[model samples]
Target: GRKRTFLACVTWFSVLMVLCAAAPGPEFFAVVRFLAGIGLGGVMPLAAAFTTEFAPRDRAAVAYVIMQSGYPVGGVAASLLAKWIIPEFSWHWMYLIAALPLITVLPAAWRWLPESAEEQSVAASREERRDAARAGLRAIFAPGIRTTTVMFWVMSFCSLLFVYGANTWLPTLMQDDGRGFSSSLNFLLCFNLGAIVGGIAAGWAADRWGSKIVVTASFLVGALAVLAFSGADGTALLLVLAAVAGYGAVATQTLINGWVTRSYPAQARTTGVGWSLGIGRIGGIVGPSVTGWIVSATSGGTAAFLLFAAVGVVGALVAGVVRHAAR
Candidate 1:
């Protein structure tokens, strides 16, 4: 019910943004962006909760990987569309172009997505005359869950740090190193392409092995890839490193989400997933800001990459802790 209300509000705000774009000013644009961000923020956790509810018992990891992979895929498409249309049309047209997908998908989602069975079951259990009270949010803080929760928070922080920081600055970093704008953009393309491949592969691998090992290995590889990306001088090397970094950096998100799902019971699953992502948004905000600040201070991307590499190392250690705790 709350999700539905939030979605309605976001839709209204989006409509208002479109209607007001014609008479736009700085204030208007700011309002629009703020509204859009609210809308985007609500969608992710809702989708994650929905995915967890509907996914098969054994295929939750694959479901999350596929869903999360859509983020980068949408980004890639948006980039391509903006490049093609912004020159001929205007920036407003870009918004219009993006809205088309929403129009199509909204109806489909409404029709197809199932209500969360966990939510229904919880409500029913609460009303049952002889039912024993099940574990609640407090269970998430129990010793068994506390460690995994902390580890996931750390992994989420580092994964998003690399995902956002690298994607935001990688092109500019390449261009600063004497590469052309086209080359820089191509690197971004290759990076997201690698993300798609890596996400699927990581899901399959995690299902076979365990999410802990996959996450740790990904961070270790990502740390090296980011370092290599910082020093990549040739197009070939840059592309190769971008692919590696994308695989390690972006795909780790899938593992983290899967691990979190397994750690909590259905009753607390939404809260757990929401809290992890909410805390990780802090890292998301910090990653780009800190990277930008370091680049400004040092006048080089090398220092920024080194900082991110350190973050990845921390993530690797956190993954190890999570594995130990799970045992």
Candidate 2:
């Protein structure tokens, strides 16, 4: 079921991406992109649930972080690709390139990606399967599960706020510090690269110790790194802080995803993950807009980063409050 859902999402988004490239006007493009977003949104939770279902139980975090590492890897690659593509051709070409996954990844996925283990275990009538799904959705809010669900929402919100806020503002913040365009862009690369490497390391740490301690510490590290951005001695130091902040923001979210996936009953896992992400996206939606207002109302990048750092602190606290699940 997850495989089928995943493939359909991929196909839906891919076709819309091509339409985006050919849009006759901004209004048309915006509507098509919104439709495409529906497809893109479904893919992530299913992918997480699918991967979690198949992972060795003890190594769920490791499997998840490995899968999630693809996001930053793709981010790093896209930054490089966009630098060339936008300058050489136009922004439209970038959309065309995104659509290439239809031809490339979709076929491979259709042939190979397996249904989630939970889905396979329940070979039943359609009504029975639907009933199971509905029960799973309701289970997330039942008794002991309800508190953790709310805490996960808080953690998810703060984590995404850190992620989108920094991503939307990092380069512009760097430029505000009197750096050139080329130098500013380098921060984005370092940011994503940090997430890729740091995320894997954090995953290993999560497996060894636990997700709770590592996630809280990562948020604190991000907060400290972001606060230090204003006082860094030079570009080199700033770059290092950017990397740490990336680890704090992006890598923390990846860990949260892993934790969310592993925390739920197999039947309710996708519903749990989906709801967490759905709620968290509101923070993502707010981050860029709020940071934009902060930057505009304030004098420099310092204020914006400071606000982001404060949000990271809140994230750390929220993460700390999460009760660990019993084995």
Candidate 3:
């Protein structure tokens, strides 16, 4: 169910991305972008849900982490492309290039992606299907789940606050600290690169140790990384600290994803992860704006980094309290 729906959503997403590229004016572009974002929104959570269903129990965390790492891997790829496309072509051309996935990847996914056994079970009974649809909403917070449900939402929120905050502003913060524009953007490159590497490592660790501790440590270490960056001086030192911060900041999401996917039953997994993702997007939207306002008000990089560090602290504490059920 998630896979077929995913295909449908990505098909629409590609169409919208093309529409965005060809839009004649700001109003049209904005509308297209909104619709495109709606399509884009479904891809990840559903992918996570689908991945959870197929992943081997013993290697669950690793499977999810490998999938999750693609987020930053994609960001890194786009950043590299931007190096060439933004100058040689226009922004619309970038959108057109993004639309390439529809042609190249969609066909391959259609051919290769398996429908989960869970999807078949739902289809087997019309009466059961209705019950499942109803239960999906109720099950995430059903008995024995309410506390963890709320905890997961909070963890997702706090994790994304710093994740998106760093994504949107780290370069700007670097620029404010006197690095050149290119150099500042390079920090973003470094950050995402570390995210790719760190996500895999975190996933492997989570599989071995459990997500609660792993995620908590990620938040604490990332916070410290940001603090260390505030004191960093040389270009090499700054990038190194940025990489460390990226490692922790981005890996936090990886751990949560694995936990949510692992913890929720298939009947309710989509709803669980979907709601968690929706909550995190709220924080993601607020994060950049909040950081921007704080930076403007304080007029200092130290204040901004301190604010993000504090978010990490909050995330760490929240993560520490979320216990893994024996399931």
Q: Highest lDDT, which number?
A: 2
Model 2, span 188-270: residue lDDT tens: 88899999899999998999889999999999998999899877878788889889989999999999988887888877888
- Computed on alpha carbons, the lDDT of every model, listed in order, comes to 0.74, 0.86, 0.84
Flag regions of model 1 displaced more than 4 Å: 1-28, 124-136, 323-327
Ranking by lDDT: 2, 3, 1
By summed lDDT, the worst window of 10 consecutive residues in model 3 runs over 318-327
RMSD of each: 3.5, 1.4, 1.6
Q: Could you tell me the lDDT of residue 28 within candidate 3?
A: 99
Please write out the lDDT profile of model 1 over residues 1-327, one tens digit for every residue. 324644564465456546445636878777776766666666666677678777776777777888889877876786676556767787777666555534766666566756666666666543541231235456567776777777788889888888889888988888888887666777788788788888888888877787888889888988999887776777888888888888877888767876776667766666677678777777888888888999999999999889878988999988977644222
* TM-score of every candidate relative to the true structure: 0.87, 0.96, 0.95
Q: Estimate the TM-score for candidate 1.
A: 0.87
User: Which candidate has the highest TM-score of all?
Assistant: 2
Order the candidates by TM-score, highest first: 2, 3, 1
Error of 1 at 273 (Å): 0.9
For model 3 the local lDDT of residue 200 reads: 90
Per residue, candidate 3 scores C-alpha lDDT tens digits across 193-300 of 988888898888888888888889999988999998878789998888888888888878877877887787778878888888889888888889998998999897
Worst ten in a row by lDDT for model 1? 125-134
Total clashes, candidate 2? 0
> How does residue 305 of candidate 1 score in lDDT?
86
